[model samples]
Target: MAATQYMTDGQGPTISMLAAGDASDMLSGYTLIEHLAQNKTAKVAQIGKLVDEQAKAHDQAQQKITDLQKEIKDLASQKKRIEALVKKYKPQSPSVGMGGVTPRMANVKTVIDQEEGPFPTIGCVRHTGDPQDHGTGHACDFMVTTGGVMATGAAKAHGDATAAYAIAHASALGIKYIIWRQRIYDLRSPGWRMMENRGGVTANHYDHVHISVF
Candidate 1:
């Protein structure tokens, strides 16, 4: 009769006969296959963890981009506000044939400059042969109409208020006289007086409020 031996199959507990050396080799091969399979499973798990970490990092990067865009928009809005303020307060250069503004005239000009109105321009001193307050750097002309034209209705009302304001603050501002709308307010007389028409708006002083300061 042939001799028989018992050994486990690699998959389960089924018994089979084999030479002793052959069984030992088969068992060693089975153990190596099992170890390889376990290693493959562990490698798959590590790859999955790495993929999850990469996905989390991608989400954080997108959030940072969104925050940076909002910051840029806010900075642009702030820049516009600063530019507007700069334009509003910027100093204007003197026009041709205009210079030599006095200290009192400059002070009064500062006050008028603070008023929110339709004052087109300021002309204080001029080079002329005529003996006028403007030629002596003691006067300022606040124009209401364009090209020395007559102002009407609302424009006239604005000019009236401007002239009145100059007269009202004359004592404090060292203003000697104000001429507007064919009338003159002399600080010496302290009243409005009608003037003879010199045949035009500029000559009659109807298009501007002329202030002479001490």
Candidate 2:
């Protein structure tokens, strides 16, 4: 037998209490409830539509994220390339020059290094200011002293005059700036009148005849 429900007050418990107890009870026995059960086919159609919309939105969001990521990667690669080029072309030092090294000087150094074989173990090579400032990167200073005798100077085993001549000759052929022995002057020497008057002699050139291959 079905269980019988008990009534407490003069009237039964109010509908509000039933609603509070279970939300579904508020719709129980209503026409809307009856239709909800009868139209399961319509509910299925609505569910399909909601699922399609959600799938489309998800696909579009994924595509946008992929495109953004690809764009970021491409930009990063370009930035790295630009930075590498800058580093590669950057001057090693300020002494290299403002516009960088001149082709003439590069060629001269190459010739000197290759053709000269080896320089003196005791002697030093002198270099002047930037080529741009001097317009010739070929300026150098070398000295040969005898036991106070200029004639004995040639007998000493410095690089032969032939080697010196080769350097000078090659510089001339290559259009490199090379100050000849005669072109040099020692303004500090006793008869340095001409060079001092012309102001062509630097202090460093006073002890050694200045040679320059610009």
Candidate 3:
């Protein structure tokens, strides 16, 4: 039998026959396998790192959503508190007998109604009054006296306080004038003015605190 040969090429087909070992070719094959294994391991490690980063990003996004929800809740609570305060302190228009009160007069009446004990009896928009703001539903009469007599003691004090409050908040309440204790305080005037004798306490406005709204 003739001796057969063996040959191999790096980039071409191989030819096999009975032959001795080729150490360089074997070493090249082993190095190629080792390189492939290393590349695979590196790729896996990179993929794991990317997955961890994605998980962290997801957690951060979820936390942000939770924080925003809490902020919305807090804002809602604050809005409720503000609304309650407005309802308690802010003036409201009267629903009943709407024809008898103007917007400004209603505001003043609301403030007076909230005053402390012994509030005066209030009357407004009387048809029998002379040609004045009362007939036009723009005036209010806070009766500080009963049966033509002037109020005394705590009643008198309450009446005084009511008048003072009205005067102090005149601009805010849109007051045109105030008459009490036989004196008149007009918004156009600088100070209280004395009136001539009207013959009686009620006639002179001493028995009532009269307020006219603009």
Candidate 4:
């Protein structure tokens, strides 16, 4: 039972207990007086050698246990990081009803959030007359950075990713066109073309991605 406990639970002994038992069994029949009377120096030397071997095996087992524990911890940390990424990229609901934007535009916002999202803000619908897409509730501005500031670093990367996603799924999302970083991808033309400079970052569509849906 003691040997079984050591092997199964790894908690009862130094794991060399089995070898010690075998050594004891080898000299079981001899009394203490008989052992002392007999010149059993060679036999005693063999038992000592057996003990040394068991000690080495025990040390090796302990080191293996330590290594396994560290591996388990590393795997757990990796799992946590993967879960965080999944949550960050998961699909989220867009404010479809709050803005006067069309359902197509709202669905596009949802798909972008699912693919490259969690944006700083999304603007749609304005009273600035002229009968444009925003005034007619057909356009949305997906902001990568807040307060109309120009995108940089991760924000710029995110805006680029959003524009790329829109271009890739333009047909499916019914996107008429997208403007970002002084460039435009028109569904009718089927290519990216540089838009004439419109002054600053906000005016030139560098601060946000503009999506117009049909």
In order, the Cα lDDT scores of the candidates are: 0.74, 0.42, 0.73, 0.77
What TM-score against the true fold does each predicted structure earn?
0.54, 0.29, 0.52, 0.55
How are the candidates ranked when ordered by lDDT, highest leading? 4, 1, 3, 2
The residue pairs that clash in candidate 4, if any, are none
So what's the TM-score on candidate 2? 0.29
TM-score of 3: 0.52
Candidate 3 lDDT tens digits, 74-148 = 999999998767667764323233366888798887776555223336778777736388888888778766788
Name the runs in model 1 displaced over 4 angstroms: 1-98, 116-118, 129-131
Model 4 per-residue lDDT tens digits across residues 146-198 = 66688999989998989989999999999999999999999999888999987
Top model number, lDDT:
4
Error of 4 at 117 (Å): 1.1
Best by TM-score: 4
Count of backbone clashes, every candidate in sequence: 0, 7, 0, 0
Residue ranges of candidate 3 with Cα displaced over 4 Å = 1-98, 116-118, 129-131
Model 4, residue 181: C-alpha shift (Å): 0.7
TM-score of 4: 0.55
Tell me how far the alpha carbon of residue 7 in candidate 1 is from the true structure, in angstroms, after superposition. 99
Position 164, candidate 3: lDDT:
85
